[model samples]
Target chain A: MSPFVLDDRLERDSEFVTALGLCQLRLLKDSRWPWLMLVPQRAGKTEIFELTPLDQAMLTFEANLVAGALKQVTGAKKINVGALGNIVSQLHVHVVARHEGDPNWPGPIWGFGTAVPYDNDRKHAFLTALNEAIGS
Target chain B: MSPFVLDDRLERDSEFVTALGLCQLRLLKDSRWPWLMLVPQRAGKTEIFELTPLDQAMLTFEANLVAGALKQVTGAKKINVGALGNIVSQLHVHVVARHEGDPNWPGPIWGFGTAVPYDNDRKHAFLTALNEAIGS
Candidate 1:
């Protein structure tokens, strides 16, 4: 098997937070929503079914863990989870915290608008809180 | 605990196909995409994290199974799986088969345009093929 490598698009768009059992927990840089991505640290696999059964279970567990933490930390009205590799086919799972009347309320967050990155202080504070919440 | 009831919007938009270990498999009525929904039979849960650990694992397994089956049946280039309850607020997971240059290429299929329902013969044939693929 080839060595695992993070997709270039995902690396450019997100900040790595911590490593879970089977995934690298990364926070998407877009400040518009509290979004975190779980990318399994497996190479050349573009779908969940491609993972071993154990890794698949681990991914689900870690995704749930992160989603619950994100909701509690952000107090989002809903948490959206998706794995759409249409644009960047790197097998990453997105867990986004949504509010009732946010900019793109009642719709998927992808391709809604240009992403506004978090400023320095805001990024540090958000990452700190998320790490504390996830106990990573 | 309240008895499990299918969400009104989900019922209105999908046809009941079969029941998996922890979910009710449903076929979205739209003909444009080969879409399937796995709704856990637990009542009043709007998120996967709300389900017990066992059910969460089961949901992951069933999602992978259905996604693989959908890909085989449709010969799609990619499979998108999501659990976004912004409008429906129901604990259901969507497994959609996507292809290159589809109407909503490289973007989410949600709220892109009005759904085009399948005709009677087409719907029957699709359901039959999907059922055979899933062995249900």
Candidate 2:
């Protein structure tokens, strides 16, 4: 298994919070947008294709489950799912909720604004609410 | 094999265009944002998972292949891949190249602005270039 150390980017990212479930379901600390980061428990794995077929299934299942719950909680009109490891190069999936009037409306959400760091109380509330939403 | 028909959305959106390849690749024609719409040879299917496992693999491979070429052409900082059936519900994958200064920068690409129809020449050029890049 790839050792589980948050890459400097993810670790220093005030946006990353605690994981929620047994599946290493970590919440990205990004509060500007309702985003979730899921890292399946496999070491040194950087791509979805890198996982065993069974693990791939698990990841897809969990990703879909969380994507649905996040949509319900965020009430986002659209949900964006992707794995762009260009910067982090880790096998993490991003599930972002998109709204109609978001800053980068109708555009890809990559190089938009400065990463809005999350504060402690807000982070706590968001994570707590997400956990409640998923009933985990 | 699923029968193929031009999606109505493809017809209405002047920005929609067909990909130059042995496969049925079509996209939103006028999206200056390097947005591609890949319509597989299926009738009334929306989600990528709906395809047979082999078809899914082929589509994913094709999408990634296009994404790589787009990155080279656009030098986008990030590439976003998604399949949202809210509007078309047809099994089409979106591979959009995102730059930092894009209109929808730092946000999801939905409800942003009116679709800018591509000029015939530019549209032809893009398709031609894409074909060359894909070596079709």
Candidate 3:
């Protein structure tokens, strides 16, 4: 795999917001909750270790920055940050903003229910707000 | 605060293991179900991004190593790997081995039960096996 190829599907996805730091910040395809994904610009990167030390710092700082923005935009009760490399091998960290009484309360978010895709307007609006918060 | 200074009692009291590459391996003071922590050592670390790219990769590699060792050592049905900075404001990741019928079964592990300090023999056995598995 080339080191810098961006998956076309991932690039065209409307759910993600392109951050000023050049990382693709996408909301998870699921709408069961307010979940966001931060995919660093580097390609062919299945693991966090694939990037250089400086890039690692960028991802980590971006994760925190994105998490804070999501909290402000969504007003969630708890924020869950994880990079479970079980399914999608891409190096993406999930910043899920969990609210009280969310589906599958007090349980793992996986395998709870089918993900509900966002409406066109809602998705666009979310992307805009996230970008604004990220100051992108 | 100095970049490497950790103020939490757990952070202060943790026993540094020979499992350097196997992640930050530490026996929970309260030995409820062979709990272990895997904190990747990186300075100026606030989130995963604070890590240099190389350190980030090393953290994941070490995290997987500890995850495998924890399963073998504890026979846990669920292995929880998370970096929640709500309590300890560091970039350390937790690799907790959990069982289905455990005290916090099918629920969050936080505030589930009082911590049970590890007995001497068990503590010795756990760390010994972990070190052997890590082989340094």
Best lDDT among the predictions, by candidate number: 1
Worst 10 residues of 3 chain B by lDDT: B1-10
Q: For residues B1-136, could you state the per-residue lDDT of candidate 2 as single tens digits?
A: 5567767775565343445332356656546577876777767665454556556556656666677677666677777666655556556666777777776565655557677776778767777787677676
**Where does model 1 sit among the CAPRI classes?**
high
lDDT of 2 by residue, A1-40 (tens): 3466656675555344445432466665556777777776
- The 10 consecutive residues of candidate 2 chain A with the worst lDDT sum are A14-23
Model 3 residue A47 lDDT score: 51
Q: Which structure among the candidates has the greatest DockQ?
A: 1
For model 2 the TM-score comes to: 0.59
TM-score of predicted chain A against the true chain A, for each candidate: 0.96, 0.84, 0.83
Model 3 chain A is weakest, by summed lDDT over 10 consecutive residues, at A5-14
Which pairs of residues clash in candidate 1, taking residues 3 or more apart in a chain or in different chains? none
Residue lDDT tens for model 1, B1-136: 9999999999999999998989999999898888899999999999899999999999999999999888888899899999999999879899999999887888999888988989999888877888898888
Provide i-RMS per model in Å.
0.5, 5.1, 5.8
Chain B TM-score for the candidates in order: 0.96, 0.83, 0.85
